[model samples]
Target: MRQRIILDVDTGVDDSLALLYLLASPDAEIAGIASTAGNVPAAQVAINNLAWLELARAPEIEVALGAADPLEIPLRTTEDTHGPHGVGYAELPTPIRRISTRSAAQMWVDLVRRHPGELVGLCTGPLTNLALALREEPDLPRLLRRLVIMGGAFNHPGNTTPTTEWNIHVDPEAAKVVFDAFSFAPPDRRPIVCALDITESIEMRPTHLIRLAERAGSHPIETVSPADPPEARSVASNPIIRHLTDAVRFYFDFHDGYDLGYLAHMHDPFAAAVALDPALARTRPATVDIELEGALTRATTVADWAGIWGRPPNADIVVGTDPVRFFDRMIARIGDHARALYPGQPVGDPVTRLR
Candidate 1:
């Protein structure tokens, strides 16, 4: 049976990729998409969400705009990372579809209530929407089949600050509320956190992007001639691969600046993958708390890995993943979707598909 799921996103580069990954997966039944403010304004996030669904030809799924800012903190956006439109270098045409009138928190409450004990909530952005839903309906934690979050850096250094990951840091209070909501839930109901510790381990270098692009029958390099404009080489007949390659180029550029060798971490996609198939990564139970006020430690996800805190475990933290296998699965599913979308097109290499 296909997993009924809702994606909570900020619609940035990685978030967009996560949407694509889930849309391409046969096991995922995307019930809805809830947009939050993190990578850009909530409005832009909603736009990106609708655009992606339209591109994937999955307009039947609902899309809703969430919080414009965190519960108490001033909103901060990461336009530098995701570009002005929150989709990096790719430019998506405006979608004709309209967002649902219901708020994101309302959508969450309605969807879970409609499919009690059968819906997975995959959050790849700030926890504001989830927290709001929890406040409105206290039983949300128990209703969800599972919750998977792509935030925090329990054992690894943070990508935003020395001790805070971007998503949680964007809204610590919201994160705290969501974590506390699950604190008393059963182990199986607690949130599964795909933190930076494991996500950072699965890096997609240029070669991987090249392979994905090739699979879509798009040229990896736009142009080899120095005289030709850089944009000329990015033209691809496959819209899906074209958009993926263009958006990834911006991400690759950002990582290159960090001397990471043009590699982008598969953070949100890993979380989405785990939401669809929990066995993709190994997890351990741990008590998690978000630091609300510590000057330099605010928004840090403190995992009680040693059991000294005496607090009940609130989250299952992912610690390991098989990069090769994970990528193989992801690429194959994406290729399958592309092929299904355009039957006669030359979908690139079949090696990954064979797996």
Candidate 2:
């Protein structure tokens, strides 16, 4: 049976890749998509959702826009990472599809209630929407199949600062709320968070982008096309390539001196992967606490209770991943999706897909 899932995302460049992976994976039955305010404004986040879904040609999946801002703090935007349009420097084709009138938090709560214990919440952005849903319906903890969050950095240093990932740093209060809400919930009721350290280890390098480009070939990319050879004549174009290329390029330029530049870590995708295949990850049972009031450590997640303040490790921390197996699975899946969506190129064999 396909795992029923509701993806809570911000539709950033990475989020777009995660969405593509979710829709392409046969194991997941994507119930819907909920947008949040993090990488960009909530409005644009909603707009970007339509473009991405249209590109993936998965209109059957509902797209709902969530919280416009954090629960307590003022809205914060990240133009540096996602750019002004919220998808790096690339411009995706504008999708005419309208966003669901229902609020994101509402969609999330209603879906969970509708599905009862069958829905898995894959959150890849700030925790505001989840927190809001929990606030509106405190009993939701018992109904969810699970909560797989993509945020936080335990032993590893944070990306945004010395101690905070962008998602958590965007809204520490919201993170605190979500973490605290399920901290003491029964094992079956709590959420599982995939931390940054584990996620950063799974990457899609520039070679991967080149692989996608090679699949696209000389044919223009933007619209849907039928399956064919790598050098086959084009039926339509694929738009995701240009934007994704620019995003990867921007990412590469930003990490010029670091090894991270070789590949862009699909942090959100790996988190979603854990939800689909728990075997991809080895997790440690512990309490997770988000520090909110710390003068300097605010928005940081701590697993153990030391001298610092953090929520109890209510959620399991993913510490290990089989890099070879993980990469093989991911490349195969992504390569298939790229071929299916764009058509042409090497459809089989990851080893020769890029060549």
Candidate 3:
């Protein structure tokens, strides 16, 4: 059975890669894409959505814009990671399509209501949209099949701050609201929270990019451009890919600065991968909570169920990753999908061999 999913993303580089993987995968059907303010503004997020649809050639799928800021504080954008455009440095032809009339939060609520127990919600950004939807439609959670979120820092040091992950840090109140609403139950009703430590540990080395490029061929560039031919569109039309490509290029620059060229963390893609194929991810039951109040620890997520820490585990936490095996599997799957989609394209030698 194909998994029916609605991707709520900030269109970060890794988020773009995840979108690409979904477009290539055979197990899922993207019901819609809802954007929220995070890596970029809500407006740009809407633009990124159009770019993605143009690239993926799947404009038929619904795309809706969501919240511009948190329910409380003013919005904060991440130009350092995703670039000024929120998609990174990669440029493409202007998106030809306009956004759906409905807002992302409304679309989410409606989708869940209509689908009823068949929709898997994949959220890879700030929790604003999800929180708003939950607040508006109290019954939405009961209708959802499952929810996969990519945010929070369990045991590891935070990426955005010393104690919090970016998505949660952006809006801990929103995070708390959503987590409070959703309940996880092992293999069935669990809300999979892919944290920073786990995802950062899963790196997309130069070898993987080369493999992706090889498989993707020249289609990626053309696909991302709104003016690209219809046949060239697919997952590449995903703004997530455009942003990812931009981020990869930026990462390359950072790598060069530090003499570590082309190495990039899988981050959002890894989280999406776990949601797409949980069998590939290793997880354990642990209590998790978002720390709403603390001068130094604001927005931090505490995960320590029993002997680990006094804090009870609120949600199932993803802690470990089989890096070597998982990367190989991801590369294999992406390559196969790329080849099938863009045949006769040259899969050049990997820029750097996988370690």
Off by over 4 Å in 2: 213-242, 257-260, 305-313, 344-355
TM-score of each: 0.94, 0.86, 0.84
Give, for candidate 1, the lowest lDDT window spanning 10 residues: 221-230
Q: Mind giving the per-residue lDDT tens digits that candidate 1 earns over 190-270?
A: 899999999888887656765565555543233211232325325655678777766776776677667776678878888
Which is better, 2 or 3, measured by TM-score?
A: 2
Candidate scoring better on lDDT of 2 and 3 = 2
How far does residue 236 in candidate 1 sit from its true spot (Å)? 1.1
Which should have the higher lDDT, number 1 or number 3?
A: 1
Top candidate by TM-score: 1
Predict model 3's lDDT versus the native.
Answer: 0.71
In model 1, where do residues sit more than 4 Å from their true spots?
A: 218-233, 347-355
lDDT of 2: 0.74
lDDT of 1: 0.84
Residue 152 Cα positional deviation in candidate 2, in Å, after optimal superposition: 0.6
Alpha-carbon RMSD to native, per candidate: 3.7, 5.8, 6.1
lDDT (C-alpha) at residue 262 in model 3:
45
lDDT of 1 at 112: 88
